[model samples]
Target: MNEPCSRLAGVAVHLPETTMTTAELEDAVEARSPGVRIPRGVLERASGVRRRHIAAPHELPSDLAVAASREVLDDAGVRPAELDLIIYAGVLGDTVEPATAHVVAAGLGAACPVFDVRNACNGFANAIDIADALIARGGHRRVLITCGELLSAGIPWRIRSTEEFFAAGPHYTFSDAGAALLMEAGPAAGDGPAGGVLATRFSAESAAWALAALPVTGLSSDPDGAPLGIGRFDYDSLRFAAAFNDLDLEVLHKPLVEAGLRWDDFAAVCVHQAALPYLRAFCDRAGIPHDRTVVTIAEHGNVATASLPLQLAEAVRGGRVRRGDLVALVGLGSGIGAGIVIARW
Candidate 1:
């Protein structure tokens, strides 16, 4: 088989120090709605999450990104000056105008071209695709990809229904986290136990975009008091189950077929840690074994784009994956975007 030019050199993760247990989250939600009744144990079992970490009140996404990036660079033995590009792939940004990547680049003391990629949950995988192209075309020799998710900011605190649903399970499981991966040019550039990108396939279902979206119409600011608005987080569990199942099956088919491999070819699958139910449904539809799939959503909630790399770093750190192992990185998120990349570890 023909080998790819770019590879993943190293990976690092940064987790918040503050841990919030399922019961605590339930209490917080119940406080918002005194009449709401939610079972803490039910929420825990449904989400498969025991506790999650959140950033300190003053911490920002960039802070976590800088720490994670430094760790990755240190592990890769690559200096900041050597980096050619830096990409921040996450839903949360330091600001709306100046790209989060610019802030992260400045913090890392990296003098490289920087930008942000917003594919929602698929941001990391999309960033990897871009980095691979840059390395292959010689536009960049080394690229640093970072993602920081401040999911806490997205929580809908005012809505009684939303509060109840979140407290019920999936909402409490989200933890703040940041992750970084260093990608370098050349087929033999990877120094870690995992090899770089082997092949990648991407597919989009724009028609289903409305199925999972943060609709602007749902937001409204209170004129009398502190800024108060509703952020549309319309994720119908039933709709998601149908959409993601179809999307995953469609996306994985060509990638696996093009690579001339089957489900058993990969030793492990590192996919977006969106939620427990979504992950399990995708695996069932894709025919991927649960044991081969990595689950961090219970502990980290949905780190948006950072989920995949965080899972990969955990696999590497735990010694579950080794060199020359065929690993599949799958991403599924808003825009109903789904993509699969086969990497040799």
Candidate 2:
């Protein structure tokens, strides 16, 4: 028996309405803390993110997912009953109890077996890998992968010191968005000059997971009085960069080898939008040309699991990718997990 090839059926994105500029976030941070100050344009300069979309107060991650899912299903012309699986892959869910996929499935009236696949930001790509295997095994034909990240909502706005603000700066680069991809069984030969998934590979660097862990529960002082159970975040940017370099070659090599492809084979590369600087550095190390990658961080910020898919959607729509063009989806996230999926589009 041979592995079945999955075709790229459709991709879509749903962004929130509200936009938060760097200056606005800076002001919000400064105003909430009595003695803390963040210089104007600091975040913009550091992250290359001019602004980020923020969800409405009443909007949940599931809502965004459903919106994107609808667009994908409609584009693919796949009915809810025809879907074999639905995987909600994102950082935050509507509830910690019921799997977020459940809510999204209900919204779509999808009766398929649904669940969540979380690996920080690598979720969408990871879900694809799972779906790919299931398809190859012949149990499933169509799988829908969706992600909605609302990381911006988790920013603790009460920090009162330079250290706390700096620790939280990474949070500032996050945005809210949802994206979806539909993969279905297709002829392997169609990937050439047509859209299909060629191969996918995933790897991890668990040892470096602690370098960029986020939103851990901690104590914070309120201006009015007592301590509050606000979430705190910390990141060692230098350490993370070093770890990426250390593992870069191996991570990319295994995938290319297994797929029997080269970095130059891709017409465009879409990676996790960590930040503009880190993204550039990663591209440089991987020997992928700068122009060959599509970046959305400057305008969309780091949208977590939605990053890669959002980039892919934009690239496809913008004509950066054409039929038979090979595109690489590289996802790197906390837990230090990484994965790559090569598709023809």
lDDT of each: 0.78, 0.83
Candidate 1 local Cα displacement, residue 117, angstroms: 0.6
Off by over 4 Å in 1: 1-4, 157-170, 188-195, 215-230
Clashing pairs in 2: 193-324, 322-345
Q: What is the C-alpha lDDT profile of model 1 across 123-199, one tens digit per residue?
A: 88999999998887767889999988877766544446645575334445557888999888755424344457877
Which tens-of-lDDT digit does each residue in 154-184 have in candidate 2? 6767887878776677888889999999989
lDDT of model 1 at residue 287? Answer: 86
How close is each model in CA RMSD to the real structure? 3.8, 4.1
The 10-residue segment of model 2 with minimum total lDDT is 225-234
Clashes of 1: 7
